[model samples]
Target: MATAVQKITLSSSRDIPFNKLVLSQSNVRRVKAGLSIEELAEDIARRTLLQSLNVRPVLDADGAETGMFEIPAGGRRYRALQLLVKQKRLAKTAPVPCVVRDPATDILAEDDSLAENVQRASLHPLDQFRAFEALREKGKSEEDIAAAFFTSVNVVKQRLRLASVSPALLDVYADDGMSLEQLMAFTVTADQGRQEQLWQAISDSWQKEPYQIRRMLTEKTVRASDRRAVFVGLDAYEAAGGGVLRDLFQSDDGGWLEDVALLDRLVAENLKTEAETIAAEGWKWIEVAIDFPYGHTRGLCELDGMAADLSAEEQGTIEALKAEYARLEADYDGADELPDEVDRRLGEIETALAAFDDRPVIYQPADIARAGVFVGIDAEGTLLVDRGYIRPEDEVPVAEPEQNSDGEPATVAVDGAQPSAAVVQRAVITIGGQVAEPEDEDDDAVKPLPDRLLTELTAERTLALRDKLAITPSVAFQAVLHKFCLDVFSRYSSYGTAMEISVRSASFPVQAQGLKDTPAAKAIDARHKTWEERLPKDRTDLWDWLTALTGDEQAALFAHCASFGVNALYEKGDRYGGGATPHTVEQRIADADRIASAVDLDMVEAGWRPTVESYLGRVPKRRILEAVREGAGKRAAQLIDHLKKGDMAKEAERLLAETGWLPEPLRMAGVDQTATVDATEPEGDREALPEFLAGDDEESPADDADEPHMIAAE
Candidate 1:
């Protein structure tokens, strides 16, 4: 048990001549993997051999040792050295360091090779990041570091960014508290405090998705591709003291501008310069806005202007283009497809021809003096000048001016002239335009209803009729079929009293904002697009196309065409002017209800809710209280009644978010009572009375004698 231990000695290492080393058959590496021999050769040439090769002395058949040695492990390094020698970069007799194994040892060459390759652990990613950082700190440029290692400059930069991440977050990453993707997302923002704050906010929630993190980090910044940023070029933005946030790890759509306000100011300044240049054209009171609303010119009179005539040279150029296009088309008429060069030439010719057609218009001197232009920036960042608008008051009188019998001027003129042709140059701001067209004044024999009232009434009637006709598909089909029969069989029957039935869609004179982007609208558009793609291109082929379809297909088409007839737009009924009687709107809505009940339609299902911006905030304190009372409970309503309108609306919005309660117009067909909150008072507690009805509404402290009352109130 006390026997002396024998000391084991390592294999003797020595510098062997490169030419003397022979490749070992027992090295065991066959297939190629990570680094190629050529790259390895270059690496060894750059920096001499990193690890010593394992080798044994070669023995002759007589058992005497030769001068040559055989390599087992580090075979790749040996091959690299061999390649270097072949390339004349290394001398064949140059000395190479290696550990020489004893031929009498029990260890197998294959075991030694396997152990050398497998026992090494890979460098940790964090360690690599720090290594890159240390290299940078030691004055190695990113490019130099990238070249030193077989990596890209961007890869080097990413590692450096990761290394620069907060020590705390790096620790978290090292401990496996976050993913690589999340860490990359944090690189979008360099502010450590902001990054940590965002992480804390989302770490407890499920909102920690990488995209969500990126969005929150850049929420206050403007994308480089945004119209405003694009208009104010990045160079100009930077020159104006604005900073940009960039993501080197991924495509960020040109990255984000850090100063949104500065970008906006630059955009506005550029727009103003463009407007000022356009204003030099002698327009009458030019109006400038960042964007004109859809119906910005609703009631304004547009002056008819003629497109500028092409000059002789321009006309000749267009003719030449057409001639060349015709020659090319005829030459390739029988070809299955035009050659790319010829196709591109044809496109150039077509564009040249269109350029002449799209020339700017030339307005008459008088119209230009009396009309104005609306200048704005288009979505493409180009100046958009909508010319030729005459405001209602600025419209010139067509009738001859009244003559004064005593030779006195008929009208007062601010310019002190003969009234300046009955037209005026003025700047009148049309605030919140009334879209409906007005009626004639002298048609009292049967005075027409006010435009707004008519629009409101017709809107409800249109929706009701669409609902009724949609559900009664058979009737709709019969009506259309009967009309078609009359058109084909009796061409002379068009003048009869029988209604000329056709789908006349009602335009949206007034619509809720974002009506086009709603889910229902998108669904309808997708369905229309599907049918449009299936339909014939030529109108003449439509009848034949329809006739070839099955009955089900025809009915489906009919329903699709009919659905466009729905119009439920709400408009102000003109309380200040002669309009349809007040009850007419109420009656139309009631009829719509009857039709809606028949079809079992629900506005809630059609995508509508009482949000703070959409409904609750727009209403008053009283309406907010009413909603809370209906949706939540009387006690909830009383609780918020003491708050101001803004606070009350926000609270009510939260209260009604899940109740599914709707305003009168948005209510479902047969729904009467609103859903209630699932809550109750504790046992032995009294119901809370309305603040008005309670005697202790003043919130006064109670006396000893009144303690019982106070306890009851509580």
Candidate 2:
């Protein structure tokens, strides 16, 4: 059997009963209140309905059309139309357009209606919660509801949970911009009443307290075992007098109640009086002075007091006791035995000393006590104190003055004059290869001379010798100085230098038997070789080599040579060739000059001469010319131009010709060709030609081709 497809037409209100437009009371209120349906009604009246209503057709048992389709969605729109009819703006019997569908389609229609309302209308939290709950009542799960609206299940649940909050708290939250996290924390209390109570408390506290304090209070309230009671108590307390607690603690104002001013003054006066009383009785208790070494000085003081003011009989007994103690001390000087009677007396003395009460007469060292001195006491009734006195034997003594050979107080001498032994010892200087004589003529004369004079004299002598040797000239002053220093070193060789060199050269024995190869032994061997090579026979050519170095080069080479020792120069492969073979000092000097010239030119070519002069050292004229020649083609011209502007142009011209550039013409003109080009052109452009070679036309090829032209199409 085949089935026929029936075409169903959407019917207007004319084909259905108008009374069927009745909607839920909630929907009707929403429409009348200008909330849900007003905008839709205005849109429909201004512009024709852009969308048709979706409704499920309802039929009676006879299948006759008793009522029109009942709208699942568009309830608000349906209500708006009814309102328009009542206002006489729309026809009382006017037909409304709607799409009819099966009864089951009401679910989708309802969902679509909800989405439309949600998209167009801004619902309150309460309204959102109601919508979610209504959907839940239709047997929809939280996940289904969330998925239907493209939201998280948790969000849907939260909205539904908001239905449990009191309207007052919700309004407060909305007004204060309180975070949802804080509100959620407050809602931890399962009981709705308790949550409301906490919410109110938090709201009230937030208005009066600082943000931190309110946060603290909120945290405390939420975690509290009995939140409802805590919140209620807080609210009641705030209602009563607790609102002023913060002000009372922080501010000086005491409100309208007690005499805080008088109380404060009285309290201050009492504190002052109490301090005075404490100060007056500060020394009421005696503190014994004792130290670890002097275990109980207080006990000794007590013993002395016990012996003071005794009667004749007591005095005799103490004298007898002292005699016995002296005898015992003598006996125990070499022996460790003590007489029973002496021991008994000592015990009695110690006991009596411990029992003495001199609190009234006792005085404390005021400064020491104020500085907080501490004393130790033991259960044996021993008071340990520090008397704070240093014995003479424990002190370091000042040295005594020494007398002269004549056994008389001698005068100290200055400037190589004879001085007392005291002056000589104290001055601590060598004079004539012996201890210097101290001056007794004047105290100031006995004092040591300043180091500046010695430094000045030494520097003058050194500079004079340095100048004699021409150390800072072609020959490295450092090399010459090193050679001179080696001569000085030779004089001290027998004193231990030879022995030290020998010891350093000797190989270390392994396990005290055989020799071992080690760096120390190698160094020692190297030193021995150096020492041998530095001998007079080996040093014949040393001066010649030293004289070969330039002042700066000599300084650097000498410093490097000196690092290995003066003897190192004679050793094989020692930085300078062995002292046996002499390097041509003149040849080395000339070669160095040539090298320096080359380096200087390299530096100038690289634009580094100024930097080199600033760091390594200055270059001589020959080197400067060499540097100019190396960079002669372009940079030399620039240098010449720079020189021409200054007084050095004549000198520069000589240097340029020496470097092999076209100096004669440049010198005649007194201007550098490169400088002229640089000054006029600024930057050279090879692509640029003479003015005559430039085109006169300014219009571009495109502009010229803009005129119409017929062309054959291929």
Best candidate, lDDT-wise? 1
- What candidate 2 gets wrong by more than 4 Å, as runs, is 1-120, 134-140, 147-150, 171-185, 191-193, 204-714
Error of 1 at 711 (Å): 45
RMSD of 1: 14.2
TM-score for candidate 2, please give it: 0.17
| Residue clash pairs of candidate 1 | 450-579
Give candidate 1's TM-score: 0.61
**Scored by CA lDDT, what does every candidate get?**
0.68, 0.38
Worst 10 residues of 1 by lDDT: 705-714
Please write out the lDDT profile of model 1 over residues 128-164, one tens digit for every residue: 9999999999999999999888778999999999888
Query: After best superposition, candidate 2 residue 183: deviation in angstroms?
Result: 3.9
C-alpha displacement of 119 in model 2, angstroms?
12
